[model samples]
Target: MRRPIEFKLRRRTLLAASAASAVAVGFARRGVAQEATAAARPAGPETSTVTLTINGRERELTLDNRVTLLDALREHLHLTGTKKGCDHGQCGACTCTVNGERVNSCLSLAVMHDGDEVQTIEGIGSPDAMDPMQEAFVEYDGFQCGYCTPGQINSAKSVLEEINAGIPSHVTDDLTAEIAVTDAEIRERMSGNICRCGAYSNILAAITQVAEERS
Candidate 1:
């Protein structure tokens, strides 16, 4: 009887085959992952260039479209006076004047206001020369922690402007008639701003003093 030919596989060959298979599988997975990542990537310029007239000065900035006006001011411009509280447009800590009107900066996108005018707390006053509203706030102790003082002062100024401009608020009794700067009017207009320090009474007093002085 003819002896049967026996074939044996080398351990080194088996190990090399296993390693090659693992390498091939790894390359396949890497290629798939790269394709998925490329597909998920967003197309277009992620940043936009906008020119804003902030505090009576022209400022040109190239910023991400997703950045809010508040972030643009506080982060890019280095104006930290506009506080970022809540960041949901609920707390008015990020309030600022855009085209002479008070707006929640957090709610506005920087790219949307390409050629808009903005006024922040820094524009309102300075340490050496404070605005009348700022002075009143100091006199009446309108703030405790002072976190919301900048927004409070900004809103207070706009409140008077709104009343003077005949913009009727919710509490206005007569829309056709001239609006009065009553407590209700002030409260209704200022309801958007939230003061966690519970200094509403003092804030009211401060605003009232400014109103009276202007009147």
Candidate 2:
């Protein structure tokens, strides 16, 4: 009355193979559907002209609407000082000023800043005419790799400007009092920037020096 072992083994093998085939077919169909859906998606917009006042100069470019301000500066304008780090606006490597406010250029679209005054590291100063912030960084050895220097300097400049303009930060003690260049203030302001080389002390010193000289 019992079935032969060989026959039972054969049946089991066939069932397993059938189940495997079904799974394979399902996966293949899912992959094809995904591909087709991707193919059906709309394409990015055509090129558009964007006018930017970069570093005090009028410049124009025809670029995709998705191009970020960082790319516009580093690629289109050939200003490579603004290092693209993290690319997600987490790292302050692409920090730059737009209309006198410090912004993460990597997160800002070039098209959105049309006719806006954009300032990058190049616009800040040259070796011969180094900006005070740049010089302070060098004098204090604020950077080791120097990849984040441009953004740090830009952000530092903005930090000082914000302090001078009485823009209170989270660490600012008195909202109604004039912002002072305190360690807490600087650290809070510079928290967005990350120096992988562990150059926080030096950067703080540089910013402090510049702030002291200006004050």
Candidate 3:
């Protein structure tokens, strides 16, 4: 049978529209598959095993290659005392002693320090017997809210060691020798540790008092 010219034209248009819809759906599904493939790819080279000496105990942890040392300590080991004020190493809240030198724990990665000694706030003292620095902080009221106290005490201990080792600060006249710990010296050296409680005056007093007693 011969169909009308208008009817034939309408049928052809419907077929073309159906084909176009099917093509669009196929592209959309392919895009979703590509996204899933990308997400399923394994993490790159930075992931590995790390062994650290924490609080006089040996511990092993497996972490992503990009995990920061601070995260390894806090998230992996459950040591929450080390606060993360600024993960960019700007704040010293995550400060810890590494081989007798204090460093911003967040600045380094866990995998970078294999067989390294790490000392966090919990490692330094205990609730039953507090370390001298902890006691000094408490007695002098060096902090309020106490978020930065751990880093402050750890940094303070290192500052005294640096002073005894003849390290110089910005206020030092000679760069080659250990600098004395005056009020200004303590202030300048301990500036890396910040307390939002406006406790600078008391913090300086605590550090100065402890330094003199040790001397």
Candidate 4:
């Protein structure tokens, strides 16, 4: 009788120990999950304010960190002249002059160009007073759909500057002498800008006209 009673008491003790172990494990798991949740929480707001000297004017804008320069121009500043073609750097439709250099605006973040100079299509010209490149594009009928015209014009202007500045490209013939604005140089430099309307000839003509006038 005594042995049976002791056996039952030992069984009860084992069962209680098992229950205690399960409770301890559950509490530990809960604590771990809570810690993970806390760690995953954001520490602060992911927004920042930046000032851009756009089109000869200082414009202050507060934008999200992830917002691209293209979006800031189109969405925030309402400068829709810079089109968002591929939203990638491949299309070059969102090309704009940043600090006198043409850059794919879609690939650049707005926060990155704090206090930097930006020139969009609107800044380049208006209906009445058009820049020389804009005039050339219109005169030569350099565009069919005009979707990529803004970027094309922007890039074209920069191409002339690049050549005159003696910036050697792949097709630059003489490295020691002055760089001439040849068809090959213009074509190679403007290769980044794509016109889906197949107006390559017209664009080339427009660029050549501008180059001749400048020379």
Give the number of the best model, judged by TM-score.
1
Please give the CA lDDT of all the candidate structures. 0.93, 0.93, 0.89, 0.95
TM-score of predicted structure 2? 0.80
Ranked by TM-score, top first: 1, 4, 3, 2
Where does candidate 2 stray beyond 4 Å?
1-44
Better of 3 and 4 by TM-score: 4
Q: Provide the global lDDT of candidate 1 against the true structure.
A: 0.93
lDDT of 1 by residue, 10-82 (tens): 6567788999999999999999999999999989769999999999999999998999999999999999999
lDDT of 2 by residue, 100-178 (tens): 9999999989999888999889999999999989999999999999999899999999999999999889999899878
Candidate 1: misplaced stretches above 4 Å?
A: 1-33, 42-45
Clashing pairs in model 4?
A: none
Q: How many clashes in candidate 3?
A: 3
Q: For model 1, which pairs clash?
A: none
Displacement of residue 55 (Cα, Å) in model 2 is 1.0
Q: lDDT, candidate 1, residue 107?
A: 92
Question: Candidate 2 — which pairs collide?
Answer: none
Model 3 RMSD in angstroms = 4.2
After best superposition, candidate 2 residue 37: deviation in angstroms? Answer: 11
